[model samples]
Target: MGTFRIEGGAPLKGEITPQGAKNEALQVLCTVLLTPEKVTITNIPDIIDVNKLIALLSNLGVKVQKLGHGAYSFQADEVNLSYIESEAFKKEGAALRGSIMIVGPLLARFGKGYIPKPGGDKIGRRRLDTHFEGFINLGAKFRYNEEDHFYGVEAERLKGTYMLLDEASVTGTANIVMAAVLAEGKTTIYNAACEPYLQQLCNMLNSMGAKITGVGSNLLEIEGVDSLGGCEHRILPDMIEIGSWIGLAAMTQSEITIKNVSWDNLGVIPSTFRKLGITLERRGDDIYIPAHTEGYEIQSYIDGSILTIADAPWPGFTPDLLSIVLVVATQARGSVLIHQKMFESRLFFTDRLIDMGAQIILCDPHRANVIGLGFKSKLRGILMSSPDIRAGISLLIAALSAKGVSIIQNGDQIDRGYERIDERLKAIGAKITRID
Candidate 1:
């Protein structure tokens, strides 16, 4: 674990470029296993989870090459199938939740895939049943080993069919798409996750000679192909990071411009922040946030009642950005209720904010009521530990806006998602230093 020593009460100003999307990178990286040819991916975020996936790919005998910064070429001409059963793989694969994605491409190409229980943020019960059930629907035999805590799927050959998913899981949809692209017949998936990440994956697969339609909708149709070739893919900017920067600017009264944010793909994110009374200007593909000297106010509903922001499926406010929204509301002019419907434990970090003098009521494991201080009360910084990736960045934003220095431990969790976060924040005039 590492720590961040942050000097607070400074306003940050300058332009910061958002890194490649971490969630998208995980799905795209796994697709490299679907082809034996060279798959070149650009704009790859040099974060811990992504690098770990790449390392795992190398260990599995994929020909890996680092072309340059944020660019890599992978050729899975000869994968060492036996390594999937090794103790090293079991340990390494369990370290990342994204590792489950590899099972799809591996099963598509090699007729078998195995993974240990994956690990990620302890937000809620993220069941793997959707993924395995999708596989089984595509004619794969799914099995789980209770003694070893391992899940395996195999089939001599897959035959595609229609499946209406129980839930529109992003990873589950990506996994099923990867498998169906190489199956014997056509596959129709309704209620699929149509986020930009999945759209990019489908586009990349199309370039590799896979037949897929309905790129940006819930219903996807994929026709199985004999084999797939390689193609170059450039991931979109991280929308979560862009939203974080917007919240950070409002929290610390900073003027910052987030560059190349792919405005079209950011569904409802900018508007959701605007509902919190945060002003943002879209300059071409970038977002400009001016310093809020008078501070921001939460907008009331049409009924003149307290506003309640909740997470929903695609096109709704993402559950990931709810944490940033909660943190920013601490200094707003009015009260708002944050409902994190997807994750139960994500709101537990609000207790730390309460210790810093913000008024927050934890209604339950999934909801919190925030009473904004309206800049009348300045927060006093204190020591805290980061619990997860999004919470860590939210705390960093709070610390930068506080009255004194604060020490944040377990910053390693933050590095799992953001790329060189401290260095990037430093470039924007934030007094944050990473301590080993």
Candidate 2:
């Protein structure tokens, strides 16, 4: 557990570049196990979750080298398969949800993969049924140990088949696609997640000699290959972080510029913020958010009904950004309803904002109604604890815009997703200190 001491009520200004997509990094790093050649990846974020995954790979005997800042090379030619069954591996794998992804590539290349029950943010019930079911559909034998909370999948050689995923889960889709890439025949996946991160994974696999089509659609077609060769891949900028910055700037009346956001890939995010009446200018690939000196105003629907923002699959507003959006709405000039359809318990963090003097109604575990203070009544800072990664960052943004000193416990939750968050915010004129 770590603490963040923040002195609030000050606006931030400067250019901050978003790190490589955290979601994309996790998926791509696991794909290195699909080939024996050197795979070089650039723009990798230096965060706790990603570093933990890298360390887990190293422990499994993958040759990992740091070429430079945010760049690494990996070779899985000498992987120690037996090491995965050890106690150390079990402990390590149990700590990260991303560890589940490694199973797909490992099963594809080695004909077997095992992992301890994975753990991650405790936002809601995230089941592994999608991943295991996808494997079972592709000719793999699945087994689980209830006593030990371990999962294993094995097959002599996977044969491709069509699968309509129960849900368009990003990780589940990535895992299934990785396994299907080396299957014996063509694999078609319907209702797949088509997020930019998943698209990047498919493009990277294609570069590595895997035949995949429908790069940006829910339906994907993959032709199995006998073997995969190494290739270089670069991750896109973190869109979630960019959205957070946009929220931070509006809430605190800050003039901040987010550089190289890869605008086309940020589907519906910028426009979604604009619905809250925050002004964002497109300066090339960068997003320039001028200080909301007059305070932003939320837009109502055409019928003069209250605005509603909900999460859905790709091209829809991401569930991850709903926390930030809800927090930002607290300072806007009007009211909005945030619907976190993808996950429950994500809206539960509004209690922390309510304690900070923001007017928020926690309608349920999945919905929140926020009445904007419009900067007339400044939020008073208070002691709070971060519940999860997205909620942690949302609380940090709220604290930055509040009045007086604030203490946030479990700052490590934020660090798992954002890289050197305090350092980056400090550079942008924020008063935040980390106590370990």
Steric clashes per prediction? 0, 0
Residue lDDT tens for model 2, 1-436: 9899999999899999999999999999999999999999999999999999999999999999999999999999999999889999999999998999999999999999999999889999899999999999999999998998989999999999999999999999999999999999999999999999999999999999999999899999999999999999999999999999999999999999999999999999999999999999999999999988999999999999999999999989899999999999999988999999878878888888999999998888888899999999999889999999999999999999999999999999999999999999999999999999
Q: State model 2's lDDT.
A: 0.96
TM-score for all predictions?
Answer: 0.99, 0.99
User: Which portions of model 1 miss their true places by more than 4 Å?
Assistant: none
lDDT, residue 399, model 2: 97
lDDT (CA) per prediction: 0.95, 0.96
Writing each residue's lDDT as its tens digit, candidate 1 over 316-382 gives 8889999999999999999999999988999999989999999999999999999999989988899
